[model samples]
Target chain A: MTARGGIDLGGTKIQAVVVGEDHEVLGQARRPTPTTGGPQDVADAMAGALGDAAEAAGVRTKALGGVGAGSPGIVDAGAGTVSGARNLPGWEGTFALGDALSRALGCRVALGNDVQVATDAEFALGVGRAYHSLLGVFWGTGVGGGIVLNDEPWLGRGAAGEIGHVVIERDGLRCPCGRRGCMEAYAGRGALEIRARKLEAKGEKTKLFKLMEEHDRPRLTSGIWARALDQGDKLATSLIDEAIAALGVGVASVVNVLDVEAVVLGGGMGVRFGEPFADRIREAMAPHLFSSDNPPVFEIAALGDLGGAIGAAMLVA
Target chain B: MTARGGIDLGGTKIQAVVVGEDHEVLGQARRPTPTTGGPQDVADAMAGALGDAAEAAGVRTKALGGVGAGSPGIVDAGAGTVSGARNLPGWEGTFALGDALSRALGCRVALGNDVQVATDAEFALGVGRAYHSLLGVFWGTGVGGGIVLNDEPWLGRGAAGEIGHVVIERDGLRCPCGRRGCMEAYAGRGALEIRARKLEAKGEKTKLFKLMEEHDRPRLTSGIWARALDQGDKLATSLIDEAIAALGVGVASVVNVLDVEAVVLGGGMGVRFGEPFADRIREAMAPHLFSSDNPPVFEIAALGDLGGAIGAAMLVA
Candidate 1:
């Protein structure tokens, strides 16, 4: 049976995987996202990543069944276009990402929202399989969410499950999206770094940036955060604490509305912090939850780093 | 051609109606809800109101096809019990509301959450007929919400659509439920009245209570608010403004997650304030909406005061 390829295009990195018919990963590849180019440059990197994954699987790109990608933007699946992917350089407008990738790889390509695809993967094959309804909270460069209702993904008017944008405090802080008091304003890694830099410039001491340079990394990836925590960096700890607090209120607000059966925490920060941080968030949710007695069961995503890629592949499957 | 009876059990009033097959109200009656009695008194009042409607419709209570009611609380449709209806005097635990009403009216009674059934009505026959997914925001004694997804009600874990409980601010004012920062903390009429009284006692100028007394209202009903607005009562206006602001953030947060196709505004204030307030809410949602360009259609509940009762009658239909 021919293998299928999946691509997870995120703000900081691109992950690609080749999977067999049983949804078992055969091979995978990762590449740094372009920080200076346009959508075309990102599309090229995606193609290259899939090519490497196919090579690792002992198959040719042309022989694959299909390829699917999870992109951070407004995905028009039928039109094969992506729009408003601001996290990517010079990609503030629509681009024919699907067509471009398909042409380069000599196969069909399907697209979906990055976080939503990861959520779908969890629901179909990971910890979410235990419940009929779930909320997937992906804490990465930016906080993202995916919602499942009655075992089906709920893409509300093409933009549902925007948990990151939910206001945690009324007009309290500025978000990366220029909005105020959104959960992402505090919890998203990108926002956290910005806050760190501003505070560091104002005389606060921290090893976050120094650690990034020591690791030869341009961005404060999850690894840098983990290292900072290991070193007991006070600034990093404070920002993370604030993030957890924001997530506690923000996530509880979502649960108060949907009252889903379970919650799965994934994404960079989620997977990095793991069960311990999940407990902290759940504890913080206590005071804000409307149904205090019947809280949703919380769990970390079981599929780990490859969850997004696998979920993307399901778009074609 | 048998008619059906429907009851809307609210915090301050009990409304009942007998409806024809076409969902047209054949007869209706309204009665003040008892503030001093327990669940039994509230149940008795519900039966008396239905009896008056049945009498006016020239049909015996037992001769009607069936009866349906919309009650506020944790409703167990399977067991026909309602629990935690705190707004009703002395009703803090499970009560066999369905069986009690059935025994009094000599008919089978079906029960549902007050807001959900009203939303069902709007989706089936009211302004919500235009959309496949809808969110019903009922602004009244307390802010209530009901959700419909893909033309079906989405009741997740038996307690979905608690839009009132969604936090609007971090560590904000205390809610009637004793929770902090909840939308209902600022917007619920019960909370509003309490604040008005507190401010009045603290020497704030307001004709709100005087207007309530002049209208012979046992509580500050929707009519009293409208009258106070017309008289330009500063305190009432200020309180209402705060409620609207809180609702703006709370409702937008829900929209950010659900992204339903339409929003139907019902309940006491919604119907009383009508189109203008709905517009105000729409404006308020602008800043907080994730997909601001593709906003949901907004409208006041078209069925007016009878929507909830009519929706309840549908339970038997």
Candidate 2:
């Protein structure tokens, strides 16, 4: 009957929430991630956020069942530390988030990849709840995926469902991770915007070009992409289709390896374009299904971005 | 101090061995696989082989810790059956190998996909024993891999590890599994033979062609390929390099996700080619490694094909 707290420490935003045993959110807070802060500063910021939520919910932080934080990058679950995160500005290796946060909140804490935490949240309380086996994919700044098997997180060597780095092209574009043709390099939101901007600079006749001209930026935003889609822009559709296909390859690979029941798409970009985008991914991935009779069903995350914070809380139970 | 029995069921041979608590092979028996027989007949033959091996080791089949089986195809471990297989002629859709064998031998039996069982065997008993994480790859008629995390197999859903079916290209080559651009489509031994035959038919000069002329067949066997490598055939080297590179993509993806310590290569092709092929895989996969400081170590399976049979025996334990 006690409550648990969850924190999602992302590159851009930090979200904290307190959830009851029934998985209902008691209180929540969000703020931008610290830019020039060390691990101590980041830990302090996380503590403040958690305290604010706890205070709003009228729950003592020490009385909470547990706390779970999902961060970006390689995390040592056993050590409960952020080993190395490249996306965030200064967290290079082995940030003792668990020890720091546990000390601050007076409870046990678990850490997971942010995308994986979102997936866990979805599997526990969102669209993935209906399926015993699910693959949760979040396509935002980078592509990330998590696998839930039999309603429990399947953390394989702390890397169960990393669909983003799955290679779709042998020698295609180089990725920051030093891999070529990874889905993250082609299907992530950043990739979509980069492609749109390239087309715009070349004076391409597409709705994306016009939107970029109006925004006066090299990259396209999710809203701009949605607007372009609304205008029936063929170029935007084509680029989105390519991104969906790439994402499909990564998802299908997971299906072939894991044979999960459903693939739930979350993150800012994954659910932004809505049902049409999900349909495109399903259509592209159908041919590569594990078996002819039964393939993975694709769905959108019900809790959306909040899934990560929810999953973080769910980790306690 | 209990002992277990393992069996590696291959098209040409059947190997049964008793492994002690320390993973040492106490006794082993090898026999030819009966090609002219029904499924039950083959099952009986395999049972007979194991019974003889157990007797030779002075252990009762029932008293043995466990029996494990490594065979080709989609295996349903829950039912201890081979659900479907492609390479083994008529072994399709749930053959009760575990049941029939257990009934005959009077012992509990565990069954798994051949590649997966071997991976387990290697992870527990071979080169992979040195690492907390590993991916075992067996390259032969088809390329298959199994994930080993902390010496345990990641048997997700009904699927274990079917890395061969991961599609690397969207529109490249058609696979027998009804997928396009799958890693197996380009790197499987069948594909290699097909590529070699096509090149020969197109008047490409190479030692492989010469060997084919000598054998009076258009197809090249593993032995022939070895001879070509010995002769320093440029075309053969190029083909081998290309195949290894493609296989590296799959391995790299696994490493990127699993962050495993080693990749153990088994099967005849992998073992016969040995360090040469393994070095190439390591080199090709290195650039795709996630960290510059450390990369997964690639090694030959010390247990060789015996890994399947050894892993099979450990199943009961």
Candidate 3:
């Protein structure tokens, strides 16, 4: 039986997986990303990870059908290169990423944006396969999204899925990308942390104050907020509501324009918030939809943390 | 030389043009739309106008290559039919509009949404041809836009251009489409008129007060507002600025998402405000762009009101 491979070269971690043709995980390995590595070193680390996974699984690299890697930033799919990725720092200006990875794994490699790779995993094995089209939005430290049309990722010019950077507010707050009122600026984890810190500095009464006391510098987690809400804290609940509202607004805009069937909310935040958060987002985003009552059914990611790994594996499959 | 025919079925007027294979207009004709007429009656009137133009140019029906009609609604380009149109009431459920017109003119016909057709025109022959891709925005009673990719209109799903319905504000202003805070609700001319009437009824001080007195009811117009602004009316200037800012924000969202090469502004209002308004929008939209200065250029339509007609001709050509 043929085996497929997946490689996820993220900002903080590197993961690779070897899977059977049925998508069952045969072997998997992960490690922290190299802090001082150049693009070549990063590529070599990715190659080593793939080798370890394949060796553990006793899978022949030549038997692999496809290899898909999820890297950061603007990926030019046609040129098989990373055009620009700010998060990775070293990978910029059209690195022949796919070629390098293909040579390393001795298989055809399809390089995609990290978020898009995550979406691909969702489409292949998550709740997305049933739908004709899906918009997967990942709300984490930074917000990122990807679109899957008919089981294939729609990589528009520059492999763009910058749904997070889409401006939601006309004259709202500034974003890290030097834009004002982008969805990321308001709804990203960073934005939520900033809001929470401001409230704390103002001496507001809340469980978040206690949550901050428990953890150094608040850690600023969506998971922490979800826990606070579960414990029935009003301030935390309001913050969750605000986050959902902002995200819902962004999701609604994408649904109205794209006419997708389902919107799968992935990433650490989405997984931590669980189905209840998904429900709140679904309700919040419903009124703004152009389609029928059944518009886009919001769903949590089926793969969870292994979404990038699973999706990356499928890239090879 | 064979001639290609083009028709623009607007709400109030029907415009037709006879063009050569090179897209040069051989002859053109325009007539008021029969509001009380049925489908066949309207088709006959449009065919008569086309025939008049064709005859004036000494071209026979046999010498014509094909005919293209650009109307307002969800045009099924594959089937050459307009399924449903809100502007043209009762025109719903897959009317073979192109077939009807083709039979009337004894020639083959192609169909497209009016805004998309105009966008195609700009992409094919107008200023947009200089660029590989663009976003064509038509600001009429309601705003509509089209995406031109690789010199052809990229009509996703049903209709080609529905940029007006893109939600700018979630749960803000009530849109006529039963949505909230769509670009159409706040920036459309219809929305502007609605706002002007409400303000006038409350006795707001402005030059529009005097203009409304000249007309029986308060009517908002780009011309009237231009004239009022020329006379140093602060209200008119502010309203225009407000509308332009909203449009800029919307266009910024589009540019950041699509990353098109240029944005061509057309229709009645777009041409009226000219380059000054276009410049302001370009400046406002730039900050939210993905590639900074590498974002789309702002351009005015060179075909004027004939953009749709010219684009229709290119469709068949």
Candidate 4:
């Protein structure tokens, strides 16, 4: 029986899973991502996690066919190098992630960005399975997207699925990517936080600040935003509404151009808000649709947190 | 000795061409479109033009393998029906153009919208041949677009290339399609004329009105616009600048998402403005590109006026 190892490498955590030939998750393990260590340390931690996961599944490392990983930032899949990854500090420049992982595991390793991997997983085994063409958008630190066409990721030219960078507002807001009025500038978590800070500076009272204080966290998580919304915080409600509107415009442009069959919303914010956010996007996107009668179906991603790990494993499988 | 017939059915005229197996245009014919007649009369005119073109090519109707037509408006290619074609006043709703033309010509009839057919022509024999993924945009009475991926048109779902309807401005000008701030609402010929009229009403000195008076025409043609721009007409320069900016934004959004290898600019306006227009669009699009270093190449469609006819013929060939 053949099995595959998958790793999801994020800023905060590294998740590893062993998937059997039957596509069942046999075992999984996770560890806090080491920020103090360099790229080699992170790679070693990933390798250790993979071993623990395979051992937990009662499978020998030598028996595994291959391993795959989903990492943050710009990924050169062909060269197996990662760059521009802010989350993995000091992991900048061209790092041979695939080669390093392959050497560690003694097997071939495939790598893709986290969003693309998650999208592949959803397309193969989650809500996107029934659709021929799908666009998966994950709204976390920044808005990232992946395209699945004919059950394969449509990597146009070299870099495709930069939906977040697409301009939604002309000269509206400055994006971290050095562009003005991009979808990410309006809808990304960073953008939401910027608005929250501005509102707080203007003497606007909100439960978000209070919740963050209680949690003793410097950054506001999706959970904090969701709790504030639940508590009827005006600032949180307005920020979310603005984000949803921007996302709607960006998504509408994509649908108008590509006319994909379905769209899956994922990431921390997307998963937390769930159907309500999906419903708002659907409503806002309706006006811009050319094929309004036969519009694409909108759904929240069903795979939850395991999507990246499952998708990475499937890449090698 | 195989020959194919092609027809370009537009609001003002019908262009027909006969092409030999070597992709050479053997003969062609054109006639004024019948505005006073019903759908059948227009169909008869198209069939007559095809006969004339075949005869001019020194080939009998029986020698022609098949016929294809590129028409205006929303086309249901499978059903060979055209709908929402405002240019053809009485040809609204579903018109079985393919069945009618097929019966009249006594051969198979393939039908597509004008932009799609033109894109096919450009992709097959013109500037887009070298690229794997291509986007063809046409600026005429209204903005229109088509996509060619891997040398085949990417007709998404049922209606693929509605680039004109993509919103560039929120709550801006109203489009003929009952939408606000669509690319067409800003860049289309009608949109430009509206701006020209408003500028004239504000007592702006312009040669456009004078030229229109000299030509004694109610509508401004691409030729007139070009002449006005050449003569340094203030209104014409300003209006064209605005159109270029709007087009740049729309195209940038498309590039950021799809990241096609090349973009082919066609239609009357696209052809007339030529390199200067292409240059402006390229410069304006540079800021919005996610991959600015390796942006998609922009080129004017090389097939000239016969692109529609040739593409239509190739559809059957």
Q: Against the true structure, whose DockQ is highest?
A: 1
Give one digit per residue, the lDDT tens place, for model 3 in B1-317.
Answer: 47899888765467789998678889988875555646666677778878888987788765689888887766778887775565454565557788788888888888877888888888878888788768898886678888776555565454434677766766668776667778878777767767766776887767875775675333465666677778888767777787787788777776666667788998768878888888987887777776674776789998887888888877788
After TM-score superposition, what is the CA distance of residue A65 in candidate 1 from its true location, in Å? 1.2
DockQ of each: 0.85, 0.41, 0.34, 0.66
Candidate 3 structure quality by residue, lDDT tens digits, A83-163: 666545465566888888888778888877788889988887888988867889888766788877545576555534677
Candidate 1, pairs of clashing residues: none
Candidate 4: list runs displaced more than 4 Å: A10-15, A29-64, A86-92, A99-108, A216-218, B11-13, B29-63, B100-108, B198-205, B216-218
Cα lDDT tens digits, model 4, B1-317, are 48999998866568899999877999999876776767788889999998999989998666688888998877887888887777665876778999999889888888888888989899989998898889998887778888877566777785777888777776678777777778888888877887788879999989997887798655676778988999998889888998998889888888887889999888778887888888998898899898888899999999877788999888888
Ranking by TM-score: 1, 4, 2, 3
Candidate with the larger lDDT of 3 and 4: 4
Worst 10 residues of 3 chain A by lDDT: A215-224
Residue A206 of candidate 1: its Cα lDDT? 98
Model 4: residue A41 alpha-carbon error in angstroms? 6.3
- The Cα RMSD of model 1 versus the native structure comes to 1.2
Residue ranges of candidate 1 with Cα displaced over 4 Å: none
Ranking by DockQ: 1, 4, 2, 3
Residue-pair clashes per prediction, in order, are 0, 6, 4, 0
lDDT of 4 by residue, A1-317 (tens): 58999998865568899998866899899875676757888889999999899999998666788888998777888999887776565776778889889888888899988888989999989999898899998887678889987666877885778898877776778886778888888888867787788889999988898898897655677878999999999989988988898888788878888888999998768887889889998898888777788888999998876777888998887
Winner on DockQ (2 vs 4): 4
